[model samples]
Structures are given as structure tokens and as C-alpha cells.
Target: METQNLGSSPDVRSKNESVKSVDRRNFLRSAGMTTVAGAVFLAGCDKDDDMTPTPTSVDLGSGDVGILNYAYALEQLEAAFYTQVVATPFSGITDAERSMLTDIRDHEIIHRDFLKAALGNNAIAGLEVNFSSIDFTSRASVLGAAKLFEDTGVQAYNGAGNLIKDANYLLIAGKIVSVEARHAAAIRDLLMPNSTSFAGDDIIDAKGLDKAVKPADILAAVKPYVKTTITASNLPTS
Candidate 1:
């Protein structure tokens, strides 16, 4: 897939550099989620029936490779969703809405490609998505799906951050999640004016920390569109 480089927003770029400067060892230690060895470790566990649907499998390799594939799977889903929205715009979709979604589609495509490149032969095959249930003709339906996707993407990154042993991989995820958060906020405002879309209990906790949804929760939310089951058993576990 061809991708256009969307130059980083100033604020995001600065934050990315700051995150890169942090000592990986110290960061992981402070988070209390780090394991002793740098080696990738996987715990053998049965696939959760609720998370894995009866869909075709996308082979994202073992260890960090698997994590990259996991992300690629999500990007494939998002890219397909936004492509559909652009191809057949929903009724009453504003010109601004169309433009913003197009930009998001471009960004996702770029992210997907970057991950694929990083993974090389380890990258998983592109997964097929079935968006037939979405009503492309209705503005409410389109925006609703976008909201769900963006929110899910952000939460997925947050939940998975601690599990990543490679500092570079974690940095990339941090960059991507910031963009996802921006997308979520923008979609929220479009849906409801002057109201914070990510300010609710769904994305934030009572302690003011951002909410992180587990992989099982994310897969369950995405189950409808994915035709094949995704196994995260190969992923690294702390």
C-alpha cells in the first residue's frame, strides 16, 4: 500500500523526541511491568473464545514481530473503514468531515506501511474486513463507527505499551497513540459541539489517568468487522 508522509504536528514531534530520550530500563522499571530478561517471553494460553472470532487468520510472527502484526491488523481494519466512508460518503456529511477522514485514512495507511516495513517478512498478511453492516448513507452511522475505531485504537496502544520490551517499538506506539487521540477528539467534537469526547469515564479514570482496555476487550469491540480469528498467544507477555 502506498502512503503519503503526513509531517508530524509540532507538538507531537517534540513529545516524541522527549519520549525517545527517556532511559528504557528506568521507564520499564518505574512502570513495574518489566521482566528481568530482554528476551521475548510468551505464556502458552488457549485463545479466548470471546476475543477470537471464526475468521481467517493473519499470521503476525512470534514475539515483537507478533506485536507489529497485531498493530498491522488494526491498521488494516481502520484503513478499510475510512476508505469505505470516503468512497461512499454518508448523507449530510460535511465537506470538513470528509477532509478530516481522508487525512486519517492517509495517516493509517502510512502507519500500516511503516509497521510492515519494520517487520519485513515477519509482517502478517492483510486481513479482510466486512463493513457491510455500516450504513454509509447515514452521517450518524459513519461518525459513530469512526468514534468507536479511534477510541479503540487509543486504548489498545495504552494497554499494550507496558508489554513492549523494545524501546523503539514503544516509542513508535506512543507517537501513533497521540495521533489516535487527536483523531478521537476531533471525531467527538464533530459528533457533539463544545463537548469533550474523551473526557468521560470510558477513556479516563477517577485518578485522572487514561483508561487502557485489554487486548481481549479491543478484539471483542472489533469482532463484528473482522471475519477471521486473531491469536495473540505469540505476543510477548511481561
Candidate 2:
């Protein structure tokens, strides 16, 4: 359950200490979603926006912090969506379904908190999730959305892996990426019982590696769940 070691240097050890005891539930509830990359957030709510938030773009800052913010934002989205799914279980959800979904929700919260802790003050404000597009009462709808998020998360981490310069950060990313992959597999299985569903052709390449997704593509993919227009103008592309 612990994140991969960043390094043996004293400073790295010090920061890693914080990652150990983080309370993800409290962290998610307390943190505010911050907008970086010169992006704007929709602060003003109006009559036409009955829970339909129209927040402006989130500009994740440049460098490692930017990458951290990017991961933080996605984790926020996943956590929020899973929270809603568990909160309002579909009418016919089995006990096993509820338990597994809850586990996924917890894992997402952990990842979100870990990124927040690792980024420290550099971390962005907590994201406000917009789940209106989802019908929480329906099993198929919930499973579909989970599949999208879990798979996308795996791809996001894989794509961003090489851009990280710090060895510890890279290690940490690898640890989290594997977990995300597992979540994707579980979600895929839930959608379809068996027969190579977990490793769908869409996510895998001929080289047998999971797909890597650019930051922009991920932002656009999860745009519906978030109220803000996220811009990764400053995120490291290469």
C-alpha cells in the first residue's frame, strides 16, 4: 500500500515520511481545487447553472509541480466519481459489487492524497466534480464511467512517466500506475465477465504496452466530470 521509495537522501526520506500517514478522506474534503496554467475557474454561479458548474480552465503549472498537479486533478475526479457511485448504489447492486466499488473509491482517495502530500504547497486547490452527466442509480451507467476513468488513469500515468526527471517521482508513479491498471482490469471485468476483456485492444498496443495518453487528451476526456475547463498549456509534453 506504500508508495515506491523516492530515494535514500535525507530530504527525500523526510518528504516520504509525510506520505505514510496521510488521511485521504480528510485531505480530499479540506483541499480546494486550484487553477493554474493561467487558466480561470468559474466562481460565479447563476440561475441557468442549477448544479451545472461552468468553471474556467485549470492551468497546471510547469515542471514537476505541474505534473503533480495534473495527477492530482485526475485523482480528484476519480475520487469524486467513485464517492458518488458508492453513495448511491444502483438498485440491483450486489454486496460483492458494493464492496469492490468501495475499495476502488478508497484507492482513488489514497492516490489523490499521496499526490497532494508529495506536492505540498505546490499542489493545486481541490477540484469540484460535476457528476450530473451520470445516472448514479443505474449499474451500467456507473460501470461505464468507472471503466473510462480507471483506464484513462492508467494511460495518464504511463504517458507522463518518461517526462518525470526525479527517480523517486518516477518510482512513485510506477507504483500508482500498477494499481490503476488493476482497477482498470477490475472495472473491465465488471463490465464483461471474461474473454480478454481486461486487456482490450483499444488500450493495448502491438508492442504489448499499455497506451500512453497525453495530458491534453486526458483533460478533455474527463472534462464532463469536472466543472472547470482545464488547460495543460504548461504541462511537460515530452
Candidate 3:
């Protein structure tokens, strides 16, 4: 699992990377409170805070913080998946597929790192994933899992949008969701080349909008791929 640095090239820069140099730490420092859409995330614990992880389950905090943690968790899973995909490329993988998958792995790594940096101490622990079900040696297995993860990620962000109180956080979520959607499309295209599956009717509504799934539903859908017991009991419902 050899991932490339975010500074590999100028064109491959991500939304957060565009702020300054591609150094991950530098990006976090540059973004500190002032630049991340001007929203200062909650710092320090409080007596009224209800976010506490039990021995059995990881609790995603409430409000905007919870939403950020939720996003971070998903990115961790995707990053790990892509890392494995690129590290042990499926048999008979084409050069184009290899290149595209590698690029995707980088993007996912950036996403995971960015969220971890932004959350600082408030971020959740590194998630332990279970990819035992996926056969990395088979292109269909790998690509199918990729498609599921990407599509779920896009829907997760979209559904969490209205629950976010901070406009800055909402804006950032929008940016990330757009990237996730692109990833979803890319994976879909790879699975079914030169076809309408990229924007198929299954994911898109009659109004041409992508599906927006609730956090609980999204988590349940991805439970098979994740080993950690994540509890969102405190996450915002409205």
C-alpha cells in the first residue's frame, strides 16, 4: 500500500490542497479556524457534552462535530479499501484501470487525512476495517466494492447536509460530496464502460438528483465492510 504524496502534481491538487502547498500538515495549519470557511469548530470538552464512546461502540458526537466525525469514519474506510485495491491490483488489470484506481486511492487518502486534520482531537479513533469479503484478486469483486463505497459516500454527505448548522461546515461537506460523487461515477464507468450506468436510474431520481440517504441507513448498509461498532445515538436527527 504505497500511496503517493498529495504534492505529486499540480493538476491532482484537492480542494483543501488548493489553499496552500500540498503538505498535509501545512494545509492543516493554514486551515486552522480562519481559513476552513471561517468556522471555528467546538474546542474543549463540556459538562453538557453527550459524546462518549463506550467499550462496545464508538459514539459520533452531536451537531456539526458529529457530522464531521461521521464523514471522517467513512473516508477512513474508503481510503483503506482503495489502498488495498492499488496495493494488490486484481488479476488482468489494465493500465488505465490501474492508473485511475491509484489516483482514486490518493484522493481518498487526502480526504481521510483532511478530515482527521480538521477534527484534531475531536476526531474518532482510526477505524478497523474488514475486507475479508472482498476478493482483491478479482476485478469484479474489487470494482463492485469500490462502486458500493463511492455511491454510499456521496449519499451520506448529501443526507447530512441539512443537519449541519455551520455554513462553513456545510460548504466543506458540499465540496467533499461533489468529489465523492465523481468517485462514484468513475467507479461506475469502470464497472460498465461506455454505458449509462454512471448516472443510472437506480441512484438518480426522476428529478435528476442523486439519492440522499440517512446516516443510520448509510451506516447499516456499510456495516458488513466495517468491523467497528459505531453508535450514532447522539447525532442530530433533524
Candidate 4:
């Protein structure tokens, strides 16, 4: 399905076009994720707290570009996980299960590509994923992992929405998060009958606003699947 227009202005479109021609390799080299270790150290180490240490720097440019790259990083992770699931087809997985997963895989790929296109040269290079911890041969294990991914995607978008400054970008994020929430609900219902994933504070509060997960919380949850560290320092703070 085609993405709905958020009514972004011509200026944003012009800026996106300017960076579209840049090669991915050059963009990666310039972003310099490898050299981020030094900056991490400089950020100071507070050993007393249990909080995950924040990365020293994020390579993607600030503003709208940084937000797109943030989404891209998540899409890459989700796409990789689903790709592995479809490739191996965990034992005892029903045809329906396989088909649903395949649809999710396609959706994640589309989301990843759309974010890359939106960000142009400011997009981060696809990071290598390590899914060795997952027992792809087991249906229970696979479904559990899927639940975690969907939940994370939903909360991540919820938490990051306020950080978006541009109305157009916020509109895009809202659209994507709605889709992610649907994916989460479907996966949840499949695992547990008569249960909506978003029910009972899974995603909403008493006021009916979506729950927001801070970047640090999300990074910690996704750390096991990702080998390369992603820095969120460049993302909008507001």
C-alpha cells in the first residue's frame, strides 16, 4: 500500500532531493560509527546506576534527518529478524503463521526503504545483525521474539514522537506507529486468544495517550539483536 501524504512542504522535499544522489558507502564513512567509542568514554561513566550507557554520538545529521535515521535503524533490525524467521520457518509453524510473518517482513522492508528514501544521504548504513541467541527452530521462541519486536517498535515510536519538530515528519511517524501497533496487536492475539495487545496499559494511559519509551530503554531492549551500537545523541531532545 502506498504511504499517505502528511502534507509536508516543498522545502522539505527540496532538501531531501539534494542529498538523494549521495552514495551509501560515502555516507557511512562520513557518519563514522566506528570512532564513536572515544566519545562514549568522554560522556562520563556513572557506575552507580543500572542504566545503559548512552552512545557518545549518533552519526546521522540532526533535525528531520536524524529522526529518519532513527526509524531506519529500527526498521533494519525488524526486517533482519523477520527475514531470518521466514528463511528457517520454525518447527510446527502453521501456514497462517508463515504467511503473517511474511507480510510483516514485507512491511518492515517497505518501512526501511521509505525511511532511507526520506532521509537521502543522511541515512545510516545498514548495521550487521546477530540473531544467534534466538532459537529459530522453536515456534515458542520465535513467537516470543516477535512479540518483543512489535512491542518495542510501538513504544519506540510513541516515545520519540514528541522529539519530532517538523509537523510533516510527525505525521509520517504517526502513520507508521499506527501500523506497528496493528502488527503488535495481531501478533499478541495470535499468541493469546481473546487478548488485545494494546489492552490493559500495553500502549495507552488513562487519558488514552500512547505510552512513550525513552531511547535508553529501547536501546537496551534491542541491544541483544544488534552488534553495532547506535547512538541517539543527534536525535531531537524536545
Could you give the C-alpha RMSD of every candidate to the true structure, in order shown? Answer: 13.0, 13.8, 10.1, 16.5
Candidate 1 lDDT (Cα, 0 to 1): 0.66
Considering lDDT, where higher is better, how would the candidates rank from best to worst? 3, 2, 4, 1
Model 1, 78-165: lDDT tens digits are 9889888888987755555566677677666666666766676576666768787778887767777888888888888888888777
lDDT of 2 by residue, 26-74 (tens): 3322231221111112111111323534346667898888988999899
Local distance difference test scores for all models? 0.66, 0.70, 0.74, 0.67
Error of 4 at 97 (Å): 0.9
Location of the lowest summed lDDT over 10 successive residues in candidate 1: 35-44
Q: Candidate 4: which stretches are off by over 4 Å? A: 1-58, 196-198
Residue 51 displacement in candidate 1 (angstroms): 29
Count: clashes, candidate 4: 0
- For model 1, what is the error of residue 109's alpha carbon versus the real structure, in angstroms, after optimal superposition? 0.9
Instruction: Compare the candidates by lDDT and give the number of the best one.
Output: 3
Which pairs of residues collide in model 4? none
User: Positional deviation of 209 in candidate 3, in angstroms?
Assistant: 0.3
The list of candidate 3 runs beyond 4 A from truth reads: 1-56
| Among all candidates shown, the one with the greatest TM-score | 3
Provide TM-scores for the models. Answer: 0.74, 0.76, 0.77, 0.72
Clash number for candidate 3: 0
